[model samples]
Target: MTFTDVLRYTAFSSDPEGGNPAGVVLDATALDAAAMLRIAADLGYSETAFLTPRPDGGDGPGGRGFGVRYFSPKAEVPFCGHATVAAAIAVAERTGPGDLVFVTSVGEVPVTVARTADGRLRATLTSVPPKVEDIDPADLAEALAALDWAAADLDPALPPRIAFAGARHLVLGAGTRARLADLAYDFGRLEALMLRLDLTTLQLVHRVGATDFDVRDPFPVGGVVEDPATGAAAAAFGAYARELGLVDADADSVLTLRQGVDMGRPGVLTVELRAGDPRIRVSGEGTAIPTT
Candidate 1:
């Protein structure tokens, strides 16, 4: 595929400058993994999405289906929420909004795209069943050391845990917004620890309200220092909150996560949890970045 084959878009915000930018290749059937990686690294985005029509796939009234893969600069990731959102919108702009199914490395993801009242396209992705587990003390300590955060800086109420929806993230709650805002960390040290633990990002969060949070993601494993807007971490955090009884599990709930403010690319991520379904729903607005 040539450079023209890639589409640049930002997820979680309609304005191209405010959200996480990603490279979306609507058709990558001719490209191999190495080529995809090279393209992703060259683009210098947090992640790039590559899609190919599946042999068993066929277009229907609902929408189209494609096998999707996510590649960071250094390696392939299991899943990427922001890139998925950006790619879905990129597809909808050409194919029209409707239901979309993405066969990802983790599992099949169902996405619904619809036009907003303001005419922007919005996409919602239902995550796979989520699971939360306690992190080992030693591992947690190593991570904190890498981040230059003391254990006392963490909120005791929220606790620390490893959560997974499509990707693995170590969720750490900061006791104060100031702690979360100051995000200078040892990149190489953190990357080594994250690689050992198989973590995609460190979901750093500071609670604003019962259902609101200020969040940041350190994505060293993905070859990025930070993610402006992270959908996978938002999904995992939703599960972590529900599993910890921080939210009402028997009833539907919505959460708002504000991220990238410190980086000056503020974006918002909406997470919805239905009572009957254990899966989390992540919704965001996306738009194509204008080419100069």
Candidate 2:
């Protein structure tokens, strides 16, 4: 089997200590599914992205793009924001800064990379069409039970729902920021429920201000307790806010998401919403992690 050099990077935050780390295989045309899974398992990151050149003149019907796939150690995911950012930067390192379209399992995602003033790389990914759905009360109860959290621990304002961008996630808002910090849960039970629900992660959040939120993600299905930062969830949250009419669509709205603070790896994600665009823009700085 052919093996390509993979780069490790954390996206959505400047500090290496922040953001979610993803394995980036910029070129994987020669690798198959089993090889990709093995690589992801060996890297042991939350997700790994494998990029292959699209067949000549096969970039969608009229779009000129490449195909990309994301894989966890256990299984393949439809899309992964952190892995997308890492792959964008990886491509930019060789191809220079510009637009790159990725054909994902869910849909096509357009990512743009630009060099920042401090000589850092910033990647912005415009998500596919997002949708939100009301979660069943019984499922919410089951989830709460799995997490060992009571109804009183949940924030009444935000409510709970299953939100989807490229993937599905259960959004749970905590009554207080402190409650969000304490995150001991039944790993096996939560993992089973998440698998049964086809959920990617549990987007646990706490509203600190009208435009600011602190978030955490429980990714038992991916064999991880918590993701440092999640861009897909941030995009889905933007859609959820728009669907709920929490922000004016005609105005430029920006939401700041603070994640990974409880895990000692703090990350900040900026979610942007434009009036005419249905796609959410998730942008953040990424840093390369040297492979040993």
Candidate 3:
């Protein structure tokens, strides 16, 4: 199996200057788990997606799409939103834009790719059934301790919770934009706690307005200090807001997430929630980064 078959692309934001970049292995049928891990490690991206043909008669559309697995340098994640978008566009480039289903460790995710009015391909992924719950006070305290932050630093409006869309994340809201901008954290300590909790990332956010927010993620468990832009977290956050009645559920709502500014790589994520639809829709544009 040659590694050349794998493709690389950035997702969520279009400029390559913005958005998260993920590695895509559209056909990983011949590669074992170890090989995939090795490739992910070599790529050194936050997450790399590996695709393998699903067995016939599974709960997907003819398996035209494959069973997808996501791996960071250090561990396997249940699912990754940015990588899924990257992989969807990669597949669309090869198989044409349409509906594709990915059987993931958490659940089945359906993604659709369509050409935008500006002639760019955009992918929208509907998250698996989502759930949100309150975070334990002790756990929240531990998280705050690891970040060297106090309860006062938290945003009272957004609160904190553990949310799941295809993966688990602890959603934390900073009290002010300055608090969000300051991101010094104990990486090793946070990683240990996150491993115990099976958390993929800590979704730290600061709301700029009712519909606009700035976000950041500390993904130490994934062997990264931070993710440039996180799609899965965005989906989970949408669910969190709906579950908390932070946003009205009767109207079609769109939320804008700005991330990665501190790291110098900025990204934008558009999250849509339709009334009466339980699923969250995440849409973004991706551009290929030219390799040296």
Top candidate by TM-score: 1
TM-score against native, each model: 0.97, 0.95, 0.96
lDDT of each: 0.93, 0.87, 0.89
lDDT of 3 by residue, 1-292 (tens): 2533767799987787678889998778888889989999999999999987764544365235678899999978999999999998888877788888888898888898899999888999999989998878888899999999989999998889999999899999999999988999999999999998888999999989998999999999999999999999999999988888878989889999998889988988999999999899999988777776
- How should the candidates be ordered by lDDT, best one leading? 1, 3, 2
Number of backbone collisions per candidate, in order?
0, 0, 0
What's the TM for model 1?
0.97
Candidate 1 per-residue C-alpha lDDT over 132-210 given as tens digits, one digit per residue, 9 for 90 to 100: 9999999999999999999999999889999999999999999999999999999999999999999999999999998
**Model 1 spans > 4 angstroms off:** 1-4, 60-63
Give the alpha carbon lDDT tens digit for every residue of 1-292 in model 2: 1236778888887787778899988778889999999999998999999988874545455333678889988899998988899888877877788888898889889888999999899998999999899988888999999998999999888889888889998999899988898899999999999989989999999998998999999998888888889988999998887877768988879999988888887878889999988889898888888655
Q: Which lDDT value does model 2 have at 130?
A: 91
Better of 2 and 3 by lDDT: 3
Alpha-carbon runs more than 4 Å astray in model 3: 1-4, 57-63
Give the lDDT of residue 113 in candidate 2: 90
